[model samples]
Target: MQTIGLPGTAAPHARKPGLWGWLLLAPMVLWLLLFVVVPTGILAVYSFCQRDDLGRVVFSFTWDNYVRVFDPIYLNILGRSVAYAGLTTIICVAVGYPVGWYIARRPAGLRNLLLLLVMIPFWTSFLIRTYAWIAILKNEGLLNGLLLSAGAITAPLELLYTPVAVVIGLVYAYLPFMILPVYGSAEKVDNALVEAAHDLGAGPVRAFSEVIIPLTLPGIAAGVLLVFVPAIGMFAITDLMGGARVPMIGNVIQNQFFKARNWPFGAALGVVFTLMFVFTYLAVQWHGRRSQR
Candidate 1:
């Protein structure tokens, strides 16, 4: 009779960490301490402290900044940021998955070329690319010109400086991040597993659902986190394509430090944002462990 291991059972062939593993990880640990940990610690301290009119830290303890962050205006802005990021993540996944899959399945000689094509846009500056979008989507821009020439519409569609335009920019900027990770997973997938599923009478949809999806889930999760987290804090695209019409959480935090001169409030927002990323990372790890079981 075969025996099944309990959920919390240790791996039967687990090995202890070696000297090489510790050595390889030393740089990452130092980087986290110097850049991420130190900076976040400073931000947390400032958040619980006060800032004077000249934007100098006063070192006085206070909860006013955190309380103000929960005000209706800021909360609404946070909600909008989450919504925009969510939309961008969804779009990236939808657009990137097929491209990644195609690249992964290509002939070895052509795969590099296809992957290069995916990364070609990064040769140009991101800001420059975003500005190019401005020229294309503006009222009297290329899109309108083309439409007018074709007699498709009489007036300009007002495509630029709108939420839709911001979403477009976000999706364009982050699609590569989503594609690369998924491609990594798809490239490593064994074709025989898929063929075996087919041989066992599994339909195309069933094979994809039961086999491909599970195998590529790690890459999907990685891509989602990469796209969603950064999209939430992107201020440039929102300011440019969104016309600064609406305030997102990113804009609010930026405004606090610049226009409002409220360093404490900005620090508070940063702390909260950092904590959110930590929680999300933990949740993803937990979910992966559960799925493995």
Candidate 2:
């Protein structure tokens, strides 16, 4: 008969952390407490509080801010933000997958070179790069000038300060996030598995659908989270390219603090926004696990 160890008994390999371990972990614990935990606590407290006439957060508790969050006007803005983010995610997946696959299949040296090119844009300031897009998209800008010179069109197109420009800026900014993860996953896929599928009378589409996609799904999931979350909350691109004509959730939150001078309301918006993101990430993780099972 086999005997099981008692629940409270330590296994032979089990050992307690020593002084070195505690010392090493201390910095990380302190960092989290200072930056994450403390700020979240302050935000949570402010969310439940009220603001005075001067727009200062008062300690008096109230649910008015949260109640206002569900108002129709704000709900519409939230819905619009979701729509924009969803569209951006779809575009990123469509454009990035092929780029990732191509880069992953390249010779090792060429692969590194292509990846360097992808990352090269990051060397410059993000604000400066965004401003560059403004230059290109403006009515009398490079795109319009070149088109006119080539006789492609009779007149300049209205490219800047539109929904189209916002989407373009978003895709440009987040494409690298999607590509890097997809490339990482695609790089690890065995060529032999693809060859085996072909041997079994599978066509390119069938093999890719059954084998390649399934294998690279983890990366796809990561890319979706990366691109979707930030895109939803992005204010800079929308403000610069979309001309702030359409207000997103991020813009609304920014307005609460700066324009409206309602810090408590802004804090409430931020708390709710954070919760929504948490819920979304958990849902995605749950779905991924369920699919795997």
Candidate 3:
């Protein structure tokens, strides 16, 4: 006997993108091809190429660019960058998760207001915001001024242009990224789940550990991806706040491209950064899938 396909089911599942669907997707596909795909391809090609005396990218292939990327100095910078980013991610998660959870659990009106305050930073240019932090953290800035007035210290604490300052800037900038995604995720979790766990004799900590956290893992993963990767390559924060004392891979890549005029090496570094990005995404995805099972 022949089986009949249901109207609202098998047909829609089997349907392929028709002309309109392709048409609708044309702009996005074009954007990805032109911007993301093309630039990545160019970077990959240049990574295997060489630069001439004039710093022009030469088409001839060699592995020297990649070899140089593995140099001890560059390796050290890469490791430091990862460490700084990791610390920043950890700090943001610790701070942001609680704030996000609190905000998500708040009443609708207050939640909107809190979320608005959290997002207020984005209203201004990020560069401007970074410079604002520069003002706040400088030796004679508001923080030290307050501390001095409060008799907290004898002199300025030298907060700016230090690793501590860099971490502060990173956390300040990326904390919102963590909070927003987490808020989105936590908002979806049912309050009923918590009560249900309590009814099942689970304490607050146990309920949070076994029930709420699992539900919110997606947001945490998203927050990690958003915070960690960009933190690693935050050149402006390091340059402005770190005083070049902490040269991250981002700064190195920037110098290679613009200051040192080493396009091939820069492109090689870009390729490595891209691979790091891909690996990070893959790792997060794998963990997310494994957790689901």
Candidate 4:
């Protein structure tokens, strides 16, 4: 006798998403299309178009804007931006990893308190915070006054309106981005695996290098991307802290739009800047996958 197959018992083919699923995703899809996709498309179109004397984007297309992007002056600015961003990423990784690790190893109550401290800066406006740094770093400011009073220096130090100040601002602003992701990764790390390494006669350094580093690589990658990307495009800090004397890529792009009245050139620079980020991220992901083998 042939056995009858039970109804709704056998595995069904994957069903097509119903109206409810689409409705749930509708808001996110609309948001991306409106804000991200549409803006990006506009930028791309503007990059190829010409700007009139008034900096209005003209309908006519031209390669002059893109050509200017490769000019020596802009190229130098781009290089400087990369150097600043790279240094910031390195410093963030060095400082944030330890802070994240320490926080993760703490008891839940203390861990939460430490995390809250990290987030406290976010409660205030970032612009206000940057301005506060200006007060502290300027000549004859609090830092210089303290040093002068203590006889640490014969004269007030000129710390504000310099490259050093720009780096400081970048590091301060992005450090939390690095810490949060690292903490998420570190908190999930298995203590048993670390203990096993110790039991197998591995030293702390060896275990950290061979096991912990590998485990937390994802967080490190994320933090680097977060810090590096924004740092490359940072304009306000460079302008406010670095005195707007030294030109960064962001400064150049901003000048093209507002100062020089060259909207097409600005758009071209922006397009190239965005593409660089996309390529860098893809390269990182490829390297990560290759290393996992």
> Which candidate number has the best lDDT?
3
Tell me how many clashing residue pairs each candidate has. Answer: 0, 0, 0, 0
Q: Report lDDT per candidate.
A: 0.90, 0.92, 0.93, 0.91
Considering every candidate listed, which one attains the maximal TM-score? 3
Model 1 Cα lDDT, one tens digit per residue, 85-178? 9999999999999899889999997999999998999999999999999999999999999999999999989889888899999999999999
- Which parts of model 2 have CA positions greater than 4 angstroms off? 1-19
What TM-score do all the candidates reach, one by one?
0.91, 0.93, 0.95, 0.93
Of 3 and 4, which scores higher on lDDT? 3
Question: Candidate 1 has what TM-score?
Answer: 0.91
Off by over 4 Å in 3: 1-14
How high is the lDDT of residue 21 in model 1?
Answer: 78
Sort by lDDT, best first: 3, 2, 4, 1
Summarize candidate 4's per-residue lDDT along 49-119 as a digit string, tens digits. Answer: 99776778898979998998999988988999999999999999999999998999999999999999999
Model 1: ten consecutive residues of lowest lDDT: 1-10
Model 4 clashing residue pairs (backbone)? none
Over 4 Å off, model 4:
1-16
Query: Where does candidate 3 clash, by residue pair?
Result: none
Superposed on all Cα atoms, model 1 deviates from the true structure by an RMSD in Å of 3.7
What digit string (tens of lDDT, one per residue) describes model 3 on residues 87-179? Answer: 999999999999999999999999999999999989999989989998998988999899999999998998899999999999999999999
